[model samples]
Target: MTGRNDEGAGMAGGKSPTADTDVLVVGAGPAGLATALQAHAHGATVRVVDRREHRVRPSRAMMLHARALEGLRPLGVTEELLNRADTTPEARIHLGRRTVEARLGHADLPDTAFPHLTLVRQADVEDVLWQALHARGVPVDWGVEFRGLFHGLTAESGGVPALSEGPVHADLQDVHGGRGVHRSRFLAGCDGQSSTVRGLLGAQWRGGPYGVEAVMADLELDGSLDSGLLHVAVGQAGLVFLFALGEGATWRMLATRPAVPSPDARFGQLGPPVPAEEVARLVRESGLGAAVREVRWSAQIPLQHRIASTFGNDPIFLAGDAAHAHSPAGGQGMNNGILDALNLGWKLGFASTAGRPLPELLETYGQERRLAARRVLALTHVIFFGEASPHPAARLARNVLPLLAPALPMLLRQRWLTSKGIRLLAQPFVHYRNSVISRDGTPPAKAWPRPGARLPDASVSVDGKLVRLHELTSVPGIHLLLERDAEPVASAALRTLLPAEGQGPLLHVHRLTSHPGQGVVAVRPDGYVGFRCGETDPVQLRAWLRLVGAAPG
Candidate 1:
């Protein structure tokens, strides 16, 4: 651990160097690179290493939820991502010829900057993150693979283990030629599910496979159609999804039967080839047969859900698929991983620069994210197999709900389903209640979701620009304070609590006069509001700052 250095001296852009960075981030996927970028911004020297010689494979995680957009906003790439991708605001779930077009954009829900999920290729998202990281002075070492980890305990004057300082070693295998050893104060594993870091740490990944397989293909369509809707057809043939990819392309697909083996076994079968004729038939059923003339990419993937037993072990930690693997039913895989990176990035940066033991802050990573992953698994089950009810009464309600869709107001309300579905699909809304990192307090008991809850999306103005509440709080490694009027004194006091230099565990203070009941609240980098204080409790504010290891006045 070391103090923050403001000097922007390190490898950035395309400059390659053989130097030791403060942090070694393995895996340049959404999770790894994001961790690297945020850590670098916080003023820590970062070196990102990835096993792949080239960019990540252009497969998986095509659906970018609204919350993910919120996370990207601070990274300064939300608009770029939207430009590179298409969107589907509504989705139709066809159950045995009984088509139910669920309006995902519900009217009652508060509007967001990114109201609907954006559909973009995985490669594009990674490309943007890579470029952003490079521009900020952290570059990834592509084609370098993480082999194993070396751990040695630091001893005090006596023969006792010194928790604060230790030498951690990493064995790396370069794709081009030689083998090398890298040392760092901390390490992050953004590698996929079969993580070498997790293996070396001997962390347990618990959860079984859903036993479903799927064939996926990315293609360009020929005719005109609303590229704003995702179509899920569940007929006698099986379940298939037609996602709109930008540039008049559609992702035509199918959901296979659940596998009988463990989660790992199921993931092994992803990306098998499918016949072009069958793909054409699926397109025809979705009314896109004439529009689709070419298949750009195709593969098969298994649907499995699981979370690592622990998110980290001392200096080494996990994020993205490395920490948790889940069913792609709701397109939640990448979203979960990115959120993990967002949560861990600032904490790691803060701990490293402050000279604190990594374990003190690292323990919270799993406590918060594992809960989210589990909840996501539950929601996926509800959407995929949660029975509305086989009872005659319940059956009638299910059938009648769709028939009433034509009404003027009802049609508009149906849009809420998409928002709700997206809420369920993306687990950002889960609050950290029981976790050690979260404060112990109850919100109003009658609140529908309860207190210590994720504050829902609301309309607000940022620097005179109207923006979604979620968008106002996306910068990573920052503690955001939303208030009604200028509190320069409070802002200065908060700044004094931060480290002298380094990217910031960023501390953002805003005044929201428009929303009256909303008082002084502190949101963590992962977008979780950690502390909510009324204008009255100055003492509690100081206590929270100290609890989070921030500087004291």
Candidate 2:
């Protein structure tokens, strides 16, 4: 079910008749759209499919963190996101009698372009990404459902003449029951928590539902609640979160109160509707002074914390909610999934188009991201437990929250503490230093841009124009950034050591006069430093490139 023996069959030479596309992405949500876009950006032909006949209008996830924005920047969608986003810098936390403001902006952190926790409906993001895909001439095959998976060319229904080892043949059915086969070098499952692909791969989905139950509704509210700030109300009753949606509904509310057990109440799925009066009552009780004029949509969400045993299953891989699902405590679900797509996108592009076996390169996608998901799960678990648990300790913490309100402003005033804390929540702190693809040719102390860490943004002159370091690495392929004084090699000379023409992503080299003497940093397509060295040694650089399949072995 894993490993490829005929890597060259579908790459380099004229398109192999065995496969219809390089990457076939299932599910057209945020993750799937991002995966397809990233793969396409990296030179892979992609196909996207979603089971729904039309796009969903409801916005499930509502926050886009800094790291996800950084990851999506290279795809040319970040500007639009910023334009449409609510770049609110703070959230007001209400605790019974006291209200405190928590900072959500990057005034304290100066390394990234995205400066705040962007508040935008998930539907707007999907629309932007789908539009990007549309501009690329890659349309989503809506109403097409992924039914089953088969390896190689022997799959029934339009089977290829020759049997191959690498490509995946997936069975798909349209809304009308028309059946067909989609053959691709790689298949990505961006399906939701109830993932058919994860089930088909037999990956163990570990974990269970959270004891807390919550209801989410988008309502037209007539109230004095500040429309510019995210609102959080914490009490022994439970947690109530409100956001100014600014669209179909005036505000969005997510309240975690013990569900009233009605015989007709449905638990997990979209709802046995939460009553209008009950919705208004929850808001009123939270002391937000908001009256729900109209409930646009309401649903009871059964929260769960779970992750798959493996992210990649050979030619088949899972991303987004399919790979992991956790409490929306920090609003990490959609952001984590977007970052997951960025991690796996370029890897799939390389594996499908390298024209040579790249087992190590392919394997790192799962190794790096699976561990990242585990860490996110741990973080969200703690936050969710603190916010929703009925334990004495949790109750004490909630009761004491108001007492600490006086200190909140003082704490937020500390630039270092606030920056570090916001960076942690914003996800710029996530790194893959231990990944196999990350290599350091120098001692840790000497590694200025540490391998496996995100390539930090720095202003430097590129051909007499000042540009951020990330702008240089934003393009598809490997970027070798060198200080003018550290490495004497010409950009043309460095290009000679990369993979044979057309074998892999192009290796772009830049010599910046203003770049610090950090030796050489080869940034990966996903904006992480894959290789870093104090001095540019051809042997070391070549070895690192070859290790990551960026150079011919």
Candidate 3:
């Protein structure tokens, strides 16, 4: 808001302290912190604000898919998360009397450092991001409630309705009793579903209640529910899922039943609140044999699946849950939101430094993410309905599902089929094929996946020493990995295109000798390969840069 809360590297990283910052990120959750950190890394001065003074309590997000982990790598937070999270490779779904289990491991994919679903509370993830942001000279200003835009509107979403707006002029109130108005070149609504930014912008959030309600609680379990195992049981009483929460004999318990009251109804459509007695009863009825010694926290959440019609408008943008909401079936909500921030941060970083809001670049954020969210929402819906529907076929599958878990290996030929199943649960397969920024070119035979996919991490030798591909490429700019001709060296054209040390264009060039005869791969800051072509072909390189809006205009 005012300089009283601003003491970081001015937004756009080096900009001097001013009421007009480059990027004012709202909410300090994974999405918000990620947006702030990535923007800071790109040298944009950033201000991160959160209405709450603390991290999310009773953490909701519990799984970090491979793609999400990869997205976090550049932020310097993924490795720490890897060290702390539990790697869950398989889940046993006990439907009726059947136990559907399969080996769900990520190790089969060599590109992923942590192939398994990293299980850590969302709070821990935020802590890691927050610590990194703090180190970068940006700290989260907690307990600041966003009121509204300062210029054109007169309404406070949080309190007294007083607002105005032009561009992204924002107003904030320090819960400790101070109010100030400020403007950022760009503002991100990384806040939760009830996003102030989204509401003020009047963006349409389409979709309705997911027709399901799930009661959940985290508690010390009976240890019989082994760590790293997620078990789901569906019966006439509805669906119950159980999974361990790190150590301390604690586990998260959930039960989803048929639709309750609608948010518009007198009862208000939400997860009908569940008491400890109800949780215990649901657990016992599902035959999940875990003694709940103590309950830490519990709530009834009406599962929701909604996506914003548009991601953002000009100086204002939406990300994370604020942009899209997902059904909890695949645990894709938080991860999808994180990826959204990842996609937008670099673009904003580049545009902010260019001294003007790049309209096309800003517009691409909504185009890419809104479409991606549709796919995720659709996928999660099928899975949710398949397990919870009352139809006969759906019922038959749920009943016979667990029985196949044991026979999957033999029936589907363990290695290949199980690996495919595991791949479905991970995010490595997602690509921005339709993105205006993602281009394609003739690729080498050695490339495992096609262009537009996040470049797979590899180990290559440079200067006679082995170096990880990520180590050199994980900087704040575009990275060019030109395959060497059996030696560690870059072609003349490749070297010519490289920027002088610490200068404009934010380009990093490296010659990788491990994959001889391969072409040059240009990777975006988000780590997705823009395109690949002959190592000496500067034309293709220039084209890729322009496509991603990274080339010199």
Best by TM-score: 2
Residue 254, model 3, lDDT? 63
- 239-302 per-residue lDDT for model 1 (tens digits): 5677665323455454443344543353623455667775666667543334557876666666
Q: Evaluated with lDDT, which candidate comes out highest?
A: 2
> In model 1, what is the error at residue 395, expressed in angstroms?
14
User: Model 3, range 420-512, lDDT digits (tens) per residue?
Assistant: 655676654467766666656554424534556777777888767897777777667888776766223434544544333454547777777
lDDT of 3 at 16: 27
Task: Give the range where candidate 2 is weakest over 10 consecutive residues by summed lDDT.
Answer: 1-10
Question: Once model 1 is optimally superposed onto the true structure by TM-score, how far is the C-alpha of residue 512 displaced, in angstroms?
Answer: 4.4
Candidate 3 TM-score over all chains jointly: 0.85
For model 3, the stretches where C-alpha displacement exceeds 4 angstroms are 1-20, 88-102, 152-167, 221-224, 246-249, 264-273, 390-392, 402-413, 440-451, 485-505, 516-519, 543-552
Report model 2's TM-score to 2 decimal places.
0.89
Tell me how far the alpha carbon of residue 183 in candidate 1 is from the true structure, in angstroms, after superposition: 1.5
For candidate 1, the TM-score is 0.79
Ranking by lDDT: 2, 3, 1
- TM-score per candidate: 0.79, 0.89, 0.85
